[model samples]
Target: MSYASIGKRLLGLAAIGLLTAGLSGPAFAQKTIKIGNVEPLSGPSASVGVQGKQAREMAVEEINKNGGIKSLGGAKLELVYADSKSDPTVGVTETERLINTEKVQLMTGCWNSAVTYPATQVAERYGVPFVVPVAVRDTITERGFKYVFRIAAKDSWWVRDQFRFLKDMQDETGVKLKTMALVFENGDWGTGFAEKWRALAKKDGYELVLDEPYPSTASDLTPVVTKLKAANPDIVMLVSNAADAILITNTMAEMKVKPKVTVASGGGHADPKFLENAGKNALYLFDEVEWNTDVNKPGAKETNAAFKAKYGYDLTGESVDAYVAMYVIADALERAASTDPEKVRAALAATKLSTGPAMICSYDSIEFDESGQNKNAGIVIVQVADVNGQLDRVTVWPKNARRAGYTPVFPANK
Candidate 1:
């Protein structure tokens, strides 16, 4: 046979095998659920996607080991993922593939807000019950789509809180940060963050000395760093994901243009690479994030420890968010007691969630109010400091010594 024919034959055999396993007997029929994942498995945010993918699969394994979703009579989870390539247009197409071709009952993911916005549109078109774990664009939930649900806090929630905390620092520490400089990538996520910061800085009585938005593909940010240095602001805040975050930090240090502190608003710096990339300069670089398993307590403590033991490294906002997202998806499936999309929608809409590191979680139950946004969830800010050259999250709010407040999580600060 020709090589093409042989390849086709192998593909046919694999399909047959999958079908046989799925159908084999009535027992299997009673317990099978397909989940579709849309994440940036390639491109600038690929590292974030890979981490999320690992955590999600691990969550499914744990759930299945415990007999899957009991409400669905031990319905096993089958996950299907596609790379969004970090492109919004591609996201829409991937969503169609998962829904039309894969025929998934429930869907989750698309980490970047830009990708999430367009992909969720696809979910609503097909009437699929979509649960978003990590996307944080304000507009994602603002559209009022009934079938879409966000279990994570929007970017607005976190950025707004960070501004409030900055004001708080000025009041408490007597650090009158007069001139402020802003540096961010020119993308949907970066644009959203820059506009919010601009408005808030002016409103809060800080001089917006400089604002520069770079393209995501900028070969080097030295020119941007030079502009920021000449402007000489009290603080410089950066907003970008993964590789870009490290690149900016490295340039800032190389140019010897360290502000009082460089605050970054993304989980990008929460990874080990931040320290590994910038060495000593990584210290005092602030970051605002969703959840930290290091602060895990009670149930979360055990879960985080188990995760570290299993994964051979620590977890980040991406990993933690994906892990919990998996459980929430399972919970929704269990509550629905059926894989029918309509029933799953009802279950997800009626969900009330409580998870590890309860302090960082939402007190309110899972319910999309109008815009399909999480009723609970909030963002947390961190100052990365090296303790003997290892990066760690240093608390900046409630004095870093105090950890109680009226702030929210799940859909935090709102």
Candidate 2:
């Protein structure tokens, strides 16, 4: 009851409170960094989105196992998955939820360009760092949003490289491709790519015989193929997702509508499910893709093997892009050394990943430019080749990027 004794008791309580607060401060600072992954987990584009989710998860696991963001006191990455359901509206809603409700600092994995376009808008409004893994519509990066970064080649790049591949084919094998037909789904991705390709085809002196756009979820593509057959183009270029890609190929076979050359502008063509659905029909189908397993990039084989072991399927271009995006985010987080969105955004702007997991894609390196586009990223053309009764994707374009000992079977040969 003495005044001195009461004062001593108060001092002891204050010292204990300070000690407890000090101990919890570092524990709070070591909290996991929440990374949002928005994908179409259940819809027409579910396959692509699911693969992205898997790859993102694998990357997060690997980063955590390897000490995570070491600069952040070894803070582990916590991935929050939100299904866009392959719908643009739903994608925006989910992205907003991830940023506002889930409170994720960074986000990646919008497989469909349609989904990515709107989802990124939400991210920009909230000032969150949105890293696009697979979406390639040029406008995604052209928007001038500082928080948005795309690691894949844009639509314009893919179209230009596709024309370059055609010219290479003509020069190498003397296979003249004069006219081309374009068929694509009527969505942001398909329509945007088709329009770019049309311009590029004209620029390259190729006549656009048939330009057709169909619904993305169309059940049949017979009429489209019939139109393409009537046009009788020397080359048939398709901009479709996985389901539409298979449907068009099957319809073409059924109607006996064949072209001298068949090329796909990536999208669904680069998906593993495309091969599974098209089977031998996919042979000689050249596609301009962001990444291919055949490329002789360092760690590609190891990454593919690990992917197959975990997912029970070959790693598709989207999967690889998403996986690399995860590393890019991890790299940014490490450099930022904080989970603050602004710091992460700044770190992303200063990214210069060249030799490591971040360089697993076909790109020589990863570096974001003024518009948040990876300037070093490039596209490669790959042809589906039939080898010993089995189908294999063979890189055929950009001689330096092509896989050795792999020859493309021209349409004439097919």
Candidate 3:
């Protein structure tokens, strides 16, 4: 070949070499997979939102520390956050921004059911995978959306277990509960629980002395408490957000509106701030949760201890769900071996995560049903009691999972 021809051929070969290197470089270089999180970090539900954010941060740190997404060239998971302020409209807009602007591959959160309901719809419209950690409205997963997956038990399941616990405790303690009062925040989450509570109470032949719904952002719940006092219910069931929970609990104590049994449907009741703010007034209050500090699962205590050390408070049920969600996302990305939304969705759909750090959940396995709901998700009832001289949430129901030496104080008001 002539010198000119040889030079041209060499140039072509060099071009091909550069193209190949460009293709293979990304395969070797560390990459980041952005997971968008839309949470209520500013408004009424800020406490729960902050808890979820912290939990996700802790989980991502652990995953990165342990070698992130080994299937994706050790790509680390990066959480991108947008504060929904517990508003549905803000949640929808933030989700769009995360997907279109931030280029996140997956999505999670918006703790309030009002926010999560519409937020998941936006994710569904975009064909992005959304993993919901603890929005308990039943209809969230019931919309036939393939991209949405929830890790916590829905409100119906929560209500079912609440009634079951009441029956089981009644059977064990031989103290009957007849009239029930249903007081919940006027939101998607609270209304969902109230609907189920009504159906279950009627079926169980319990009279509903009061059915009241108040705004979560109400500056004063004294009126609600006063109504509850007048109702004089044997069992008082409450569904509230953080601020409202504290207000109602303290107001009840101030008014001395003690019922035979007071039950709370997690949410604000499970918030650490509620216990801290309500103090002894919240004692003997039965609340439903996905997991507790004293749970029987492996890694439960250690993980909670680590979280408490880091955040200055123990992990709540809402936070634990968010923590486990990171592991589930990592597991999905590992199985999918790619960051493609469809691949990640498929992997999430086929997930059967029964082991690893995520097993700290009360359920043995994490599997999604046709509706994208965690089929094995379970709930537990815990009573706020004095443990070691400090108010602590002690698991009490399900007989088998009750704390080793603590018997629940049923009929809290005698």
Candidate 4:
């Protein structure tokens, strides 16, 4: 072979080798950012948690499709989920694992407050930013943790929305309000809920008829039902999780002691599966939610459709909020110029971002006061409207209710 030909062949070989390495770059060299989660995967709250996972995955999927987090310089997202199984200890253990083993810098959250309370403490101890999506209890933030930030409004917001709706119900229906009976499951979510509801009942000039907390694992609440029925209140409300909501509704059906209205405060619509299972019995069942963009002014339908197309299901607030929250965190991470705990906290505190279904001010200016609570947050009010396949979920009260937020009915002082 000619010397010139040999030189050309060697040059071609070198070019080919360089091209191969460049082509294999992302597969071998891309950075992976791990985001941790501990949520119910096997218990009654599983539906809610699963939906959140789906939504978060969908968001990460979409973002990755668009070249991933800008600051990560194309690093892909990795979500590590620990099925908490609706247990607090499991949640704590998962948090520890995520922090120590996985070395994840951020966490989404567990859906149940029982799970969230303990999991949040772990985040506090580790100084990881936990972006809470749907769990309510104000205590999550009351502990003064710097790393904990709840985009989802707390229980106080929902309780307040319920009061506003109750007042409106009286004004609209002309039903003179008299008695209120509060029922809830025995858990963190239930504990905070019952306390807030009782306080509201006192402030609203309503006689407290039945105030009770039943075991969350109770198979049959017939005994609780009997006592609540005996009170004979003009109105009844449950501040329990999804399972209890279904059970209470079923028991109410069995006892045939229908009150003027039955409401499920915050835990009412956590899962679409439960809502579907509740069936006709769930009709007129009022629920307070932290996010739902149905009544949103604009862009909500597009975002909801995008999520539906990605996940192959109708998106609820739980999923939508988490998906948006990921973006919120990502945005803040970019804005603050660093993911350091303190810097991230400061950016989150100064967040005035907006999302698709931000009826609860998820899109408004997000500034946490010293208490770490977003002041401009709102909630969505959803009423199960199925009268045996005749009607679907309907929004009756606030013509423009966006956040399913609770209107104030408590702490007459506030």
Best model number under lDDT:
3
User: Model 3 — TM-score against the truth?
Assistant: 0.92
Question: 1-414, model 2: which lDDT tens digit per residue?
Answer: 999999999999999999998988667656788988889898778888888888888988999999989999888999999888888898888888888898888888687888999889889989999999878889998888989999888888888887888898889888777888988888888888888887788788999999999987887788888899899998988888768888998888888887889989877888888898988777788888877887777888898899899888888777888888989999999999888889999999999998777677876778999999989887788889887788988888888777787777786334
Whole-model lDDT, model 1: 0.75
Q: lDDT scores for all predictions?
A: 0.75, 0.86, 0.93, 0.73
TM-score, candidate 1, is 0.89
Question: Per-residue alpha-carbon lDDT of model 1 for 319-356, expressed as tens digits?
Answer: 77787777778887888888888898888887776642
Model 3, which residues run further than 4 Å from truth? 1-29
Q: Between candidates 2 and 3, which one is better according to TM-score?
A: 3
Flag regions of model 4 displaced more than 4 Å: 1-27, 268-270, 310-312, 355-365, 386-390, 399-414
Please identify which of the two predictions, 2 or 4, would achieve the higher lDDT against the true structure. Answer: 2
Choose the strongest candidate by TM-score.
3
Error of 4 at 368 (Å): 3.0
Q: Using lDDT as the measure, what is the rank order of every candidate, best first?
A: 3, 2, 1, 4
Question: Of the pair 2 and 3, which is ahead by lDDT?
Answer: 3
TM-score of each: 0.89, 0.91, 0.92, 0.84
lDDT of 3 by residue, 15-36 (tens): 9999998998677657989999
- Return whichever of 1 and 4 wins on lDDT: 1
Tell me which of candidates 1 and 4 scores higher on TM-score.
1
